[model samples]
Target: MSERDDEEREFDLKWADGAEQKEPSARARMLAARWKENPPGPVPFRADPEHVGSRRRSSWVSTAVVLGCVAAVIVLLGYINFRAPY
Candidate 1:
């Protein structure tokens, strides 16, 4: 074999010896241990009294606006179809 072929084989052999895996850092291990003792609890739910009424009112307004838009589109399409020569 040529020198190039020998050098290529040597490189492949060296590369095949994969890198060693590393353990978690000290901070990561500490956090894991701490959570094991006392893990997080479920999130608490909150109710806003003042905003509830406004939210319902805005929902009704939005529904009215969407319905109005649909009606306008249907009327415009009917007008277009009626005006079409074909």
Candidate 2:
């Protein structure tokens, strides 16, 4: 085999065994052990109570505006169709 081929083969073999002989570092092993001892629980949602009333009021106002706009458009279209020369 060529010299370059031999060098590539040596590199591949070195990495293959180098990885197998490795273990997790001290910090990683400690974290894994601690996680096993006390795992985390699901997070809870938190909302501010002071702004809840204002938020609800704004939502209702926005809904009323949207419905009013839709009603106006429907009436305008009906009038246009009725007055059209067909």
* lDDT score, candidate 2: 0.91
lDDT for each residue of candidate 2 in 1-86, tens digit (9 for 90 to 100)? 69999999999989877885678889989989998999778765866787788999999999999999999999999999999999
Q: For residues 2-86, write the lDDT of model 1, one tens digit per residue.
A: 9999999989877765547657889999989999999878764865778789999999999999999999999999999999999
Stretches of model 2 off by over 4 angstroms after superposition: 1-45
**TM-score for all predictions?**
0.49, 0.47
Reference-based TM-score, model 2: 0.47
RMSD to the true structure for each prediction, in A, is: 10.3, 10.8
lDDT (0 to 1) per candidate? 0.89, 0.91
User: Which residue pairs clash in candidate 1?
Assistant: none
